[model samples]
Target: MTGRKVIGLREAVAAHVRPGATVYLGNFGAQLFAVGHEIIRQRRTGLHLVIGSGGILLDQLLGAGVLASATFGHCWSPVGPGPTWNFRRAAESGERPVTLYELSLGLLTAALTAGAWDVPFMPVPGLPGTGYTDENWPNGRTSRVDSVFGAADVVAAIVPDVAFVHVDQADADGNGVIPGPLGETLVAAQAARAVVLVAEEVVDTGTARRAGIAVPGLLTSAVVHRPGAVAPDGAIGRYERDVAAYERYVARAATPDGFADWLAGHVTGGRDA
Candidate 1:
């Protein structure tokens, strides 16, 4: 069906996402800033975010105070390899509102894999003495499971209510191409209850097929035509990562007042990306 699932970003988010919903954002590098910004703008509360590499995108959402909890592999700036001030502050503060569940990239991917497979949990390497198992730094997502070979550490499945994925090109039916590193995006997309395919360009089915469809139409729930959706993060072969933008954001968001002002000027003001 043509344009059956095609919709605006605002409409798609409003339709699929509700307060306190679990949302998976994007790939390791090609983060969906547009969708994150929209979620912030709408002031959606009590969200449980699942991200591959949280980075500044997750930092923005956390700073906006819209998240009740978050599960991520890591959160930082790749540009300067700088700290995400909001995330750092939240983590360090005793009264931080959000609950954090951190895991290794391997474990996170395994969790998504479990979800995709509709399984109970997935076994991973046991880090018995690490902070992951420490009571003081409890992650609350790990456990031991008895198997044929003995006991194994397992990560719980992570099935998000909705997943927003960035793609280079997409068709009307939601089939798309994702170039470069796949990361956890493919599994996260499959694991999600609904997949919103955000594309830099919308082309014909033949074109998308020729480009090699990474996200099948049958697996996609919606398609949003958002060019430069991953700005500041960049799309492979389309643009380079905006280092200045990252640096400026990191500098401006160092303080609470600075972050508020930056949010006002960039996200909540008028600019979408």
Candidate 2:
């Protein structure tokens, strides 16, 4: 675990993240809200985001007009199971004009699997009558492949330019511990061209080893020591989700002007230390 570079969050984002990059923010529930906010504050734009569960974090990025397109399972507040107004606004008004590709959790995982395996596509169970099977629905993300068994639906590989995964603990060498269910985070990390591990705590190599590394250091491009990195979303064994904050955001960001003001108050002109 020696020689692994640990940098500040702003430096990490500035060095690796670029405009129009395909980025994956990890963990289905423990989403990286801090990184999303940093991307906004830095005014990085035209990103194509890939998220397992596009929670309020994704909604914030969409609201900030920082994303050009997004591939996600769904977008909503898991707290109230409330609607993400910004996402709804974009979809309904088309004012921001973001291309959205929605997928079932199963299909999204399959796509990541394909990317991880460096395969053209991965066969998944057919969705029968869903729009996924429609040739033009997700715009060529799915196709039918015939085998001796029968015809099967397949999803194209989704490789991100860089993936930002929040971990409970990470060493300077980039080894990370992800407590609880991995969801698609591990595979997405493997599929990404580069990987950034943002940790709640930075420990020594021995501590990281004892914790059991879910993401190996070799796959990591950089490690960022960021406590409360997933604030509002919560990290396993560290903190609880701020449900009130989620509710407050939903209430305040109900309109375009409201969201603009909210962003200014919370994210705009914010300095990264």
Candidate 3:
């Protein structure tokens, strides 16, 4: 129970998270994503969410009232119009219900790559002149530059704690293969101090040793075995969307009281508030 060990998903949820931790989760839909909703439900951990692109689950986080702060690459969800209402309200009311870190998805990924490689910052494309090739950016807070980057801020993009990914497969030795939503999750995984992987299946460590493993060997700290666990509307083939459920959740999310109710019944699965 000390070093790296394979654990049940709920156990993984309760154990590793601390109150002030930033978590990077990789997914495109429900089938190939970690059960992050459950993870949030079972714990009181304050979180700074770093999402590559938004999804239904992201809205669930905002509705749940437990999310501390958040940053993301995009807010385009296949299901519920991203978290526009949730975000718009939070931004306007200055509620601080969730803190917003604005950076494009592409830039965020590059920063993670640089952070993982131990470089000062990744040299990606975009931005020119002044700091990070400034070339006159809006208020000017850019610190680095490259071909695929402009006004990059590594401090905003780096994951300080762990990235929890739900992968298609993993070796017993904790090498994860996220064939679906790679999303520079490998970089996120490598840069973080630890990676908590929930793999769909555990294959032989020796056979799959050099195959599609994304995160390098040394970076992973633990593997939690949740063979079929995935996020809602996160991935494609692993699981399909429950469309009826999504429709109902949307109406409930329309107002604050409605959202609270929706969070209770749908997102939290009628669990205690």
Candidate 4:
């Protein structure tokens, strides 16, 4: 294997992501804590994070003060109906003061789809009179356009500067196989200017090809071998999501002091801890 595409996590993040860049993170089955940890360790600031669903990983970035703004379908913990504490505090109290752009799942998917297709905007039906569309509509990013079909509501394309995804397996060439749900990972990978994949294991090219590549090598800029990269969150067949850890986090991260301690111990001190 040439291993030209394989790189370390730190190098990948430093090379691909810059401060104040718009970043897309692959959530659901491909959520990556490892990449999030590295981003925090490097102390990147003013990042505009975009995720289909903002889960615990997104919370980490928010708590660390890495984000200047966020665009997401939802922001909640995987364990409960409660909102992520950091996100809530930021939005409600202006503690960290992050700009918010909320969209529905369908709109988020459509935006990424438009981005992947390299289109200026994507029309989404049945969203004309919604409250979200009325209140938080992206002014310059979207506009009402009349087409051959008719006038429809559309969202602007979201081509992120870089996308970070954790997959089940990949090859040295950067082709990846995701054994479970694709979620928005595939579209995010295709839409971003660069993609960095963190894999549980790196296999041969033939193996990756045979397994069926969900993310093609051409779209991937770098691949890092990181087993249990999404720990505290599941990776489908690899392991179950650490519900216990998440519960602990939710409990501790509810307060400022508790979150600082948790960050010092787990994130700032050591990633594995």
* TM values, all candidates: 0.95, 0.93, 0.77, 0.92
Q: Report lDDT (Cα) of residue 13, candidate 3.
A: 62
Q: RMSD in angstroms, candidate 4?
A: 2.1
Candidate 3 runs further than 4 Å off: 1-4, 28-34, 80-84, 127-141, 144-157, 206-211, 234-236, 267-273
| Model 4: per-residue Cα lDDT over 1-273, one tens digit each | 449999888898899889999998776545678888888988999999988767877888899999998888777886865557887787787454888777777777788889999998888865557756676644345568887988987888899999988778899988999888787778888899999888999999999988899999999999999898888787777888888888888889899888889899998887543
TM-score of 1: 0.95
lDDT of predicted model 1 = 0.90
Displacement of the residue 168 alpha carbon in candidate 4, Å: 0.8
Q: Which number leads on TM-score?
A: 1
Candidate 4 achieves a global lDDT of 0.82
Candidate order by lDDT, highest to lowest? Answer: 1, 2, 4, 3
Best-to-worst order by TM-score is 1, 2, 4, 3
Model 2 residue 181 CA deviation (Å) reads 0.6
Per-residue lDDT of 31-147 in model 2, one digit per residue for the tens?
898899999988899999999779888899999999999998889989887889989988787464899888888888889889999998999887767777754445678889888
Alpha-carbon deviation at 158 in model 2, angstroms:
0.6
lDDT of 2 at 101: 86
Task: Compose the digit string of candidate 3's lDDT tens values, residues 51-70.
Answer: 77655556667656556876
For model 4, what is the alpha-carbon lDDT of residue 73? Answer: 73
Indicate whether candidate 3 or candidate 4 has the larger lDDT: 4
Q: Report lDDT per candidate.
A: 0.90, 0.87, 0.61, 0.82
